[model samples]
Target: MFLDPLATPGFKRTLFNAIVAPRPIGWISTINAHGQTNLAPFSHFNLVSTAPAVVMFSCNTPADRAEKDTIANVRSTGEFVTNLVTWELREAMNLSSFNAPYGVDEFELAGLEKAPSLKVRPPRVKASPASMECKVLRIIEIEPIVEGDTTSHVVLGRVVGVHLDERLVDAHGHFDTLRAEPLTRLDGDRYAISGRTDMLGRPSPRRD
Candidate 1:
């Protein structure tokens, strides 16, 4: 079937959102300059670079709230932490996603322990297998195509510190992905866990 994005979908935004499937969830935590803590989950997040250990996440304006606490806190203090969610912490992580007030303590609400970060004011999720403390490098506002419509603000942070649970690591100091059993978001309310698979290198060049 052939259809123009503007015509067939009726709403181009919803169509585009669904096409981008199963993005990795970033359970972000941050603290404001005033010492108020905030936690939220974002799917529009990924590692952008490795040289300086950069990660980026986008936070959209909340429907009911005037501003997103994650964005505000990051802008205020220039620091945040990204906690890797595993299958075991899925329910707790989801609780953190609630759109509560700015002063609300998500860690307490979700019943997750807060592990003090080495360099950042925001604490990391102790139950999480891995977490990265980051300092904000940049915050870019994604301008909307039309006026009066504001797009999500993309926050890029440099990972300055890392925390890992020894149980999830091997004796060789390598992260055991299988043992981690990381949880990931699927379409809509669906979710998935990492599966066991064989490693296959790229095919070699064929000889004439």
Candidate 2:
């Protein structure tokens, strides 16, 4: 079956998300200029580069046409934190995804405790196994091609500070992802855990 995403009648965007199955969730935390904290989850989030330790997450404008608190906070303060969601904190992470009003503290709403970041103003989730304190590199506005399509803001950040629980780190200083039991997002209402991870090595290049 052939499907033209540009011409699809309904759920095209959702279909796109499902096609990109099992995306990592960036549980983002940010602070507004007035020092209000915001926490939210974005499945369209990933590490884009390792040289400078950069990560990015995208935020879309809702039907109300108001900027999300995370986006607004990032723009306001130029910093944000990426918190790793673990199996034990799955319910708290889900609870924080609620569409609460601006200035509403999702940390309190989700019953999660906040830990002060070392280099950034935003606080990290105390329960998270790892967190990245980042400075905003840029925010790219994704313009819509067709009418009625919403705009999305892609926020890029450079890792300035990192917090990792020693329990998840090995003697070699490598992160034990399975031990951390990180959580990921599947299409709609579905989620995945990384407890049973598989290791694969890249093949050596063949000489011509």
Candidate 3:
């Protein structure tokens, strides 16, 4: 079926996320100036560049129309940790996404352990298989594409430190994606895991 977001009067913001298929969950952890910690998942996240090791996640305005704690904390502290979510921690990750108050600590609410990060004030999820400690490059407020679009902010961070569970790595140093079983974001309350695995090589260069 053909759908035109701009033309449709009842187009949903979720349609964009749903059409994009499974997206990696950026289980971000951040701390405010007063040491208040927050954790939230953002599906609009990905590695933007490799040379400088930068990653980005987009946070949308909530129903309350107030600034989200995650965005405010990241702006205040200039740091955050992207904790990789796996099937094992799915429930905890979901629990942390609740619309808690500003000072509420989601880690404590989720009953998850927080491990000190090496290069950032924000702690990492101890149960996560991997985490990227990042310094905030910038936070850009996204302009509305259509008139009624809610406010959104894109947070870009430069990866300053990384943590990988040694148990998930092989002797050759390749981290097993299948073993990690990373959780992915889906439409509504649905979620997915990296269940199957395969590889495909790039085509050879065409010779004249």
Candidate 4:
């Protein structure tokens, strides 16, 4: 039930992502220096600031590699887009998570169309109901808990532009969550649809 990650032998580096229960998935899209596109999902992502609209996603460096394509691309281009994953795009979202090679284009890999972003070079997910076009503010690499294991690159960005589905908005301009049906990451192979765990439970489809 309780775990001290630093002291526990053979403790998983990724278990905390599960311990936190369901987490919002940042379906990040980025383009490398050479313009090769990349998309990847990170559960360790959330809005860190409100007024200036900032978000952060922790990208763990693979044990066998120096960094991931997402981290490298973000570092190279200093821009990225966070696409909200919905129930409709769950399969495509899962497909984009495939561990392809460095130059692989996940958009095409997922068989998803791309929409031009307003303020950033990276394209937004056309099928996604919402997308945040962000410019990198900072990237911090944490010290590894297990000494030998390289840690995560915490990439922070300022949301400069937002794309929202007009139909999902209300008279008051509130984006409907239930209508979006966003997907959240859970432990292991599990994933929970948005509005399921947080508002207790709901019958039918009503925004809480």
Candidate 5:
């Protein structure tokens, strides 16, 4: 199938998301200026850099209404936390994405516990194997989907602190991802877990 993006109107409605399957889910948590907590998940997320430790997530901007609760919260407070979505927490993570009204406490709605963050005001998922507290670095607005309909915004955050489950860490300080069973989004409602996998090592340049 030769999918020409330029010819296909609303190309995203086609195979854009499906082709980018198995995206790591970033279960985000934030607190509004009034201290109201909110939780949501974003499949459009990934690590941006490791030197300064940055992560990014993208979300749609409602053209006719206010921004998403999570986005608004971070804009107001300049902080948020990225909670790892593991297999066990998948259900809660799904429920927390509900389009609830403003000031809704998603933690209570999802029946999940929260843990204090060291360098940020937002709390982390207590049950998550890992969480990264971040400070907002920039929010870049992308071109609108169709102009006056909806738009997308990319958020770049600098990881200020990280909380992890000690059991998932080895003596060499490597993370045991297989043991954590991190969850990922595969297109639509389908999802996947980091289970068994093959391994390979990079060849040394000198070996040639």
Candidate 6:
């Protein structure tokens, strides 16, 4: 069935999010100016560039609340880390998604270990197989269509440092996807892990 987005109520957003299936989950962590730590998982996140190593994530404000802790902390300090979620850390990552009060330490609440980052104030998840420490490059605010409705802000960050577990690296210095076993979010509460069938390679371009 075809429906116009302007006429449909919430259908457009629902369909759009679903159509972008199997998005990489970014378990983002940050620290406010007061040293208050916060953690949250965002599915509206992806790597945007590699030249300067940039990644972006969109954070939407709830109906009655202001921006989320992740957004607030990033705005305050201009730095955050995108911790890769694996199957083993799924439970702790899920716990971080809860709407906790300000100054709450999600790392402690979730019972996960924090690894000191080389280039950022916010620490990375020790259980994460890979994590990227980034500094905020820009925060683009998406204007709301209705009044009193907070907009979604897209935060772009430049990766300054990267941390990876040695187990996930091959002798050739290549990352092993099987070793990582990264977890992805599907629609609703469903999640999935990449399998061998998901692997593909592109043929080299012909110079005729």
Question: How well does each candidate superpose onto the true structure, as a TM-score?
Answer: 0.90, 0.95, 0.94, 0.89, 0.93, 0.92
Worst 10 residues of 5 by lDDT: 143-152
- lDDT preference between candidates 1 and 4, better one: 4
Report the backbone clash tally of model 3: 0
Residue 15 lDDT in candidate 4: 78
- TM-score sort, best first: 2, 3, 5, 6, 1, 4
In order, the Cα lDDT scores of the candidates are: 0.85, 0.92, 0.91, 0.90, 0.89, 0.89
Instruction: Encode model 5's per-residue lDDT on 77-180: one tens digit a residue.
Output: 98999999999989999999888888889999999999999999999999999999999999898876454446777899999998989999999998899999
| lDDT score for residue 139 of model 5 | 89
The best candidate by lDDT is: 2
Looking at model 6, which ten-residue stretch has the lowest summed lDDT? 8-17
What ranking of all candidate models by lDDT puts the best one first? 2, 3, 4, 5, 6, 1
- Show pairs that collide, candidate 4: none
Superpose all Cα atoms of candidate 3 onto the true structure and report the RMSD in Å to 1 decimal.
1.5
Model 5: residues >4 Å from true position, as ranges?
Answer: 9-14, 145-149, 206-208
| Worst-scoring 10-residue span by lDDT in model 3 | 59-68
CA deviation > 4 Å runs, candidate 4: 10-14, 195-208
RMSD of 4: 5.5
Model with the higher lDDT, candidate 4 or 5: 4
Query: What is the C-alpha lDDT profile of model 2 across 13-123, one tens digit per residue?
Result: 687788897889999999998888989999999999999899999978987547888998998899999999988898999999999988899999999999999999999
* Clash count of each predicted structure: 0, 0, 0, 0, 0, 0
Looking at candidate 4, what is the lDDT of residue 132?
Answer: 99
TM-score of 6: 0.92
On a 0 to 1 TM-score scale, where does candidate 4 land against the true structure? 0.89
Write down the TM-score for model 5: 0.93
